[model samples]
Target chain A: MNIERYDRQTILKEFGMEAQLKLQAAKVLVVGAGGLGVPVLTYLNAMGVGTLGIVDNDMVSLSNLHRQVLYSETDVNKSKVVTAAQKLKEQNSETDIISLETYLTPENALRIIADYDMVIDASDNFPTRYLVNDACVILNKPFVYGALHSFEGQVSVFNFEGGPTYRCLFPEMPKADEVPNCNENGVLGIVPGIIGNFQALEAVKMITGIGEVLNGKLLLFDGLFNSFQKIRFSLNPENSKIKALQDSYDFNCEVSVNSITSDDFLQLLAENEIQLIDVRTPKEFEKNSMSFAKNIPLSQLEERQDEIIFEVPVYLVCQSGVRSKKAVNKLKEARANAELINVDGGMNEILKHAIKY
Target chain B: MEILLFGIAKDIVGRSSFRFEEGDEVPKSVLELKQKLNNSFPDFGKLSSLAIAVNSEYAQDGKSLQRGDEIAVIPPVSGG
Candidate 1:
């Protein structure tokens, strides 16, 4: 270890050489390289954490450059894990950075997490959050949890020394479309930086025995108000009794909506006049939409059910396939027997093929 | 009683915090508070998971409330 590199943090009387040594010996895994994972990995590596692992299957898009400061304009369209690992290595070569270019699924979560001492739930989706919680609980490992919603952010330490788990705070994963993600809702670039730093601080505290960790207490920060609130919670014994992973962590598992590929939908469109509903906002629909599709924003789906023909299969399309699936689910509730099919990949996929607007 | 909203709950309510004044028929329990919010804003009912905190501590549905108690409605956030 380079003793001079960590002299500043080690010089503190409370966090002396012992704490530095603990941070050097700790092995932590961060499960996303987008917003929260960037700061967590950056700080942990710069502070001389021994081993760090990054898991993500997403590519650095133009939109990610705001909060994901690790990636630049040149890094767009590149794999997030690979780019993050390379950048982190340049920041601190002494820290062993392991890059796992895959999403944490039920099958691979346990095996991947078992190699690390601690996990950080920095993912941007509820499925991965719940998967991380369950996997950490089953493996008897502690995880630093951080999530964001627009200007608000949440940070918590779960399964730390028998403390409360994420399930204890919010029992079930919120259904798809219940809460919009950053991609859908939007987040201030600085919000995740603030929250991720808190997560890194908690991880260091837990590893080095510094200040009190946030176990059983959820720290909520509202940037708009410039306020912080800590909600105290207790562990539900039932949450810790998980012997195995659930069969599926997919958010859309609850609603079994049939789907068709954009290519197949186009082929069907040529053969027959299909009833397609574009569920994107008016602005999005006006920007680009198929001539045959009807514009019905998801926000107004409930009131405009009469416009959609329930006699034949209704095809739903959005910017991405997410909102289309949500539309299918919503329509299913109103007309249970209605045949609804979500256009997979939505307009993004359809645009790849030759088609007339 | 003052109710604070976080995450999607804040968006659904359109304000960070609100109050039920002295003579108002405030919710007596966490469950009633949720029901009231759901009744006013149907979006609250759509959220599959929500956490209520009384005096900055997690409160179950049956947890009783008082006039001066501070309540927070927190829904799960799925952003990084």
Candidate 2:
């Protein structure tokens, strides 16, 4: 170990050489390599965490550059885990950075998480959040949790020293369309940085026993108002009694919508005169869109239902595939017989093929 | 009673905070508060995993509310 590299932190009265050694011996796993994961991994590695693991199957896209500052413009379209691991290793050579280019699914979550001393739930979806909570509970591992929505962000430490778990606060996962994610609802670029830094601080505290960990407390930050609030919660004994993982954490089970890949949609467009609706905002539509696609943003779909032809198969698309699925659900409520097919991967995937508008 | 809204609740109500004035029919419990919000904004009922905090402490559905209590409605946010 390079003893002089960490002189500043170890020199502190509260955090002595003992704490530095603890950080060096810890093995932390960060679940996402996006906005929140960047700060958590960066700070933890810079602080000399001995072993770090990154899990993410997503590739860096142009949209992610706003908040996921770790990746550069040149790094776009590259694997996030691979890119992050390479940069993190450059920041600190002594730290062992393990990159797993895969999404956290029910089949592999337990196996991947069992090897780490603690986990950082930096994933960007509800299914992965619940899966991390259940897997940590089942394996008796502690994890630091962080999430964001628009201008507000949340941070908490779950399953740490008998503290409250994420399930103890929000017992059930929200339905697929109940709440909008960062992809649908915009988030300030700095919000994730602030929330992720909080997560890293809590993780350092938990590992080094330097200060009071955010055990059983959820910290909410509203950047619009520049205010912070902490909600104290207690553990539900039943939550810790989770003996096994659920068969599936997917909340989209209720509504079944047919989906076609972007490539297949392109093929169909060439062969037939198909009806396609771009469900993104007007600004997004103006930026780039298929010439055949009609603009009917998801927010205004209700009032513009008459503009769509229900007799034919109507395809829905957005920046990503999420909002299009929501549009399908909304359209189904109004016209149950309408055949709505969501374009999987949306424009992001279509752009990959370099097809002309 | 003053109610604070976070995440989707804030968007549903179209504001950060609101007050249930003395002359209004205020909710007496967490469950009633949620019902009141759901009655006003139907979207509130769609969120299956909403949490309520009273005076910075997590409250159960049956927990009684007082006129001066500070209540916050927090919905799950799935962004990183």
Candidate 3:
């Protein structure tokens, strides 16, 4: 296919022409083109990975240039996937880069992921992460998991060769507030570049079977400390129970349970009819938090087993409201008599006047 | 127990590692150790989703910790 182009890697004893041939036949779908996807696609193309699909709904901004090196000032405000595909095509004419200019929604995840041999999770948010995991789980495709925050990042391979999945390692999703996204918490430009390079390596390893892919092992990279920790994780059958793709990241709730608008949430807070529990961590709480809210981080919610007053409804909230919805589920399962509700949009809405249940 | 922290766990604990000497005031189990940390640093409570590692392997909440057990708090990260 492209043996001559990959001769440098093909010459290696471990990664000979056989591995190069496998890489040429491999079809990979990368779910984001922000920071991680950019380098991942670049390296994969350089390695001559045959079929590459890119999914992204975001447009490049001036802010994207620091880390997303593929885009330029002229490319600002243009579609990320489109720009990525064009750049990658120019960089490697042998690799076919297909650009899908849309967000990876649950409705479209399976169809897109099914068309690929494997998926690389380069998304920046939790919803897409969970969606991609479930889609790959259903499709029975191996996925390279990559996530980063500020100076730290994690790389792992899930569902490959019957190893553990992302849900196996992370049973619960952290509240959005607890997560230090690159946008708010701020990440060094090199953080994702390093992590993305690892992801590309993992994909190449998976495709060519050249090296030991990080299956069942979670690799954490702390850019600040320049340290890497590879932690092994056992398969958790209980956590791998994904029968279908979920509509929301709210723990597969079919209906929003006792969800209240921000107006009603504040009104209840003012009237003292409802108790507001910010499920975000105390560090997040200290950073411009709602004064009326109580600081009960989700991790310590188990200690609040006896503190629940069944009569007063407890409203749970986090950054984007995904974690609060999870808190609501946990409370509902543990305390049947307790009335637990979720405040939609979490602090994002609290910051903005408009809110939804 | 000198508990080590990684990723967002470090942000919550404020330090990379802290000692939790076994005693009446100290914790004997992983769950208890987490509760103690949560009390000291309320941010630890936010990481309800974190996994604990004793020595090198992952330990369950029910796993008991000895006096010299090396502990590390692991937090899930999402950025890229």
Candidate 4:
């Protein structure tokens, strides 16, 4: 590697040659090649962070071009990790870039994150964020957290050597619907640039051991006001609740139909006159049925248009809420006039309530 | 009490503002203060995940509150 390429960063007294070499030997994994990941990757790569791993399952959309600088208009439909790896390589061949062309799930997250010295949570969703935080906590790795919405951004270093985990600061995840995403609420392109760069700085600081690490503190940035605030955090012993999150997290976060009781269902049924549309298999429907309900097995619902006349509100019921939600979504796509609701408890909940066939 | 809004809350709520009220008693928990705000401005109930702070401190969900303290409601942020 040519030393002149990083003369600017090397000149800093704190980040001298020794620190640069540490950065060169560092293996960092950046999850998500979207808005925040773009700047974080670019800065780290430019500063000669040796081995970089980029993971993302999404391709470039037209809307993403405004903030995702690694991609161009021509790379619109290309995989983000692939395109980003290629561009980063072209800019600085000194850095070895690896691209994982798949989504990070609980099953594979531990292995993938375990290989890296540091992890950056640049993904957009809460489940993935929590997964990254938990995996890092379990493995005892340092993970940098950065998040941006509209003109504001938050950066924190969590799950590092007894430092605060995301769970310590926020023990519970929020309902998915409470927050509007970039698709619904537009973000200023520069907002991510500002945040991602700060994340990159944190990554470098963590690697080189220079400057005050965010550790248990959360840093807030406002692009609209050009202001920054740092809020301190402490490790909550109850955050140990995250220890059980290792393997069986699936059951821990699984959506059960049991969340809503039979009484709640009855109230909704009476108040909204909600009609149950069982989308279970015909054999399953024959085994049990709800009174005042229509049987439209999921397999035949698409072909049997006359079976469902969507004049009234429909509550979809299946073995679990998963298939019913899909059926409801399909019904909505079919331009049905009914408002869709998923009886989360499905047949199990119905059976528990002793609903007659 | 005064509250600060950051990230998603700052964006959606437009800007952090203040309200004038008088009370002798301090609240038992941050959730109670949150309820008071939600009742005062019903529109904010939609932002249930928004985290709150007391006097520039990261406020816990069920922690006690005091009078004349500064408070801020920050939503679950999604940036990086």
Better of 1 and 4 by TM-score: 1
**Candidate 3 lDDT score relative to the true structure:** 0.81
lDDT string, candidate 4, A110-138, tens digits: 88988899998998867688888888877
Compared with the true structure, model 2 gives a TM-score of: 0.92
lDDT of 4 at B44: 65
**B1-80: candidate 2 lDDT, tens digit per residue:** 99999999999999999999989888999999989999999999898889999999999999999999999899999998
Give the winner by DockQ: 1 or 4.
Answer: 1
Q: Alpha-carbon error at A159 in model 2, in Å?
A: 1.4
**Which prediction has more favorable DockQ, 2 or 3?**
2
Judge the docking of candidate 1 as incorrect, acceptable, medium or high. Answer: high
Q: Stretches of candidate 2 above 4 Å error?
A: A266-273, A333-338, A353-357, B22-25
Error of 3 at A245 (Å): 1.2
Task: For residues A1-357, write the lDDT of model 1, one tens digit per residue.
Answer: 989988998899999999999998999999999899999999999998999999997777677889999999998767889999999999999998999999899999999999999999999988899999999999999999999999999999999999999999989888777888887688999999999999999999999988899999999999998999999999999999999999889768767779999889888888898899999888678867999889999989999999999998899999768889989988998899999999987886686553344
Question: What TM-score does chain B alone reach in each candidate, compared with the true chain B?
Answer: 0.97, 0.97, 0.85, 0.64
Could you report the DockQ of all the candidates, in the order they appear? 0.90, 0.91, 0.54, 0.52
iRMSD of prediction 2? 0.5
Instruction: Encode model 4's per-residue lDDT on B1-80: one tens digit a residue.
Output: 66677655554556755643576444568988777767766656866456676766777768887667777677777544
Better of 1 and 2 by TM-score: 2
Predicted structure 4, TM vs. truth: 0.75
Error in Å for residue A243 of model 2: 2.8
